[model samples]
Target: MNKYLRRALAPLAAATLGLTLLGGTDAVARPIGWTAAWAASPQRPSEGFTANWAEQGFSRQTLRQVVRVTQAGEQARIRLSNAYGTSPLRITGATIARAGKGAAVEQGSVRHLTFDGRRSTVIPARGHTASDPAQLTVGAEESVTVTLYLAETTGPATFHAQGFTDSYRADGDHRADVSGRAFGEKTQSWYYLAGVDVTGGARSERPGQGGVALFGDSITDGFGSTSGADRRYPDALADRIDRPVVNAGIGGNLVLNDSAWYGERGTARFERDVLDQPGITTAVVLEGLNDIGFYEAQAAGYDRPTYFPAPRVSAAELIAGYRSLIAQAHERGVRVVGATLLPLGGSDHYGAHAARVSDEVNEWIRTSGEFDAVADFDRLLADPADPERIAARYDSGDALHPNDAGYARMAAEVARVL
Candidate 1:
């Protein structure tokens, strides 16, 4: 066993063997409390900007990305993923430190991250690796910069396309650099890195202190929200709640079927994205918008036969999907909190039939009692004059996603239930 795992599992081993030191003093091991401090859902490289990343794989370069963590801790670990890679990924070195002004690390705060005591390791295709715990103190709402040096060519890297936060890239290896001088290029997506876990410390001792995971589509993904500011509804909700909040949303994602541009369907990824997250006691599901919107486009005869397939879905089918998600969460002892789909009346794909279906599904969410609780995002963001449309002030001009103000209101609504 790796040294870190052995250390982590020592308590379990001693308990299983019923052994104690010669003095008969019971050796009580300190429980290692892990909490999901930050996370970004991984997605396959698709067309447009993301495809460019797939083509230009990293070689002899350093990639430094900043992630804002919700839970504070005295020690932390980093998770790197090659979930969709076509070849092995080798990391020559890596460092984690408190983020400074821009693309820079705070002086005297940089710490080396190791894997089972090794400074470097190879991640096989479709696999992931987590670093050994590093002694780096961080406070809640602090941004941490993780720098990685790729010694080999990484082909078709698995990445989260819409990080909405700037990441820096520079030629040659600079994983140990403490300043931003080496970085020359900026990108707005997170590559390879998947999650940041922190030792729970005192927070773990509190009753019902487990984190909340927000699972949804673009709205939850912070599409219309301001970039680099973390203004998503989940972010706002996290600011209000004491427990950690992890955003598992993907832009253009669907609940039942996978789209080319979006990542996997919500049903397919629920276990890995939500159920597998450490310390997640509650899952707030807000999906089905794209599914309904696509079906509406097909009904309106706006779907291109070659590009877009004709979508057929009903309110019953959507409710069944929700029920499946709720049952899965319940099986894992995670409270399921359903969120009603927001209004999209002014969207280009909105149709009268789609509006009716949305109403039917929302009514089921509100009255079905299948979920432990419900967040009425639809009611909160809908226009008072026309219940079908979103309020003018809240709409992001796309009608599909919400503006920062709208997201704040959505967060306020979710806060009441959390």
Candidate 2:
């Protein structure tokens, strides 16, 4: 018990510990990095695929996206979507492989994917399925190419980029059996692929995890980021942060309840859109203007357009809805950040009506103090003098969605808050 006696025994204890290290039977599991994760924003067609529209362009083709992995690990999952295609979207074959060498089909490793019941089958449109977690290994900062072989086409596709992006074109038709055709990668094009949901770590532990929930309209759904660009604001934010981003933005989604655009406002779907996320920690909301514009139109004397009219939501109503949304999110411990409505002054989609409603909503978002934080997408990309217009510099031609540069600006501004 004496200090000198204890000190004398310390070396014996230390030596024994070292000897145990050499012969001990105990083993520790390596930490596998697995943390909370979510997709940035999700998009589906306004209407699920129907037989009538099959002639237009309804069909399930191979949908793929490249996931850039930060640290190599041994387990992973794939979040496959049938969110927009009509009819059950079936997957004939799915695989994850290392990026191919060049224009050739490069194969590194392969894994089979399954649906609710079958390995090769269809997923109901507007529904989703996550592949069973698989055991595999990847390297630090490596890229995994997830490729899904397509079945027959039956409905119009709700692809990643609604606008335009550079894509490959084969000389002859190449949809039926694309087994050995040489492929091309357009470095500067936009891609319709949503995102890759992955899980990994060292040892038996999970990975360091964080996630982003992208809540907005079609823009957040990635309408205009360069095709294959993978540069939606949410994607941009996700790539910069050490977190998984899941996009919940649906085109034509409103903030207040409405019969049009899927029978309700974005709020109605929040439970499914925001709460249902696998592991969401941070969420960014960009809505309201749609409600204001659409509702206000009917209120005015504008006849229900056999064609259409401008948006008509009132400022007070939109603000109140936002308040409710904020309160609900806080209750769930999810940080809700507001996004100012972007300009649509020149959009042929809506006349001046939606633009005015947009102005009212943006004003409230900037001044209301109703959210945990605000992402001023309007200030970042709007025309300074007009305020109602997207800066000519940032407009994506139609003047509704932001161009690549415009998206970049929006992302940079949002990143500041995160």
Q: Model 2: runs farther than 4 Å from truth?
A: 1-74, 81-93, 99-105, 114-128, 136-145, 148-195, 201-209, 257-264, 293-311, 349-356
282: Cα error in model 2, Å = 1.0
- In model 2, what lDDT does residue 285 have? 88
The regions of model 1 sitting more than 4 angstroms off are 1-30, 50-52, 298-307
Q: Mind giving the per-residue lDDT tens digits that candidate 1 earns over 1-418?
A: 2333233322111211111123346755344567778888888766555424644779989999999998888888887878788788998999999999888999999999988789999988777778878889998888999999997888777888888888999999898888899998888888888888787455645756588899988889899889999998888888888888889998878898876677888988887777666678889999998888877777677744321573677899888888889988887778989999999998865887788889999999999899999999899989999988899999988888999999999888888897
Cα deviation at 259, candidate 1, in Å, is 2.3
lDDT by residue (tens digit), candidate 2, 131-245: 5445556654455556665555545443433322233322232322224353332322112233344444442133223345778777776776776556766667766665556
TM-score of each: 0.91, 0.67
Q: lDDT value for candidate 1?
A: 0.82
Span of 10 residues, lowest total lDDT, candidate 2: 11-20
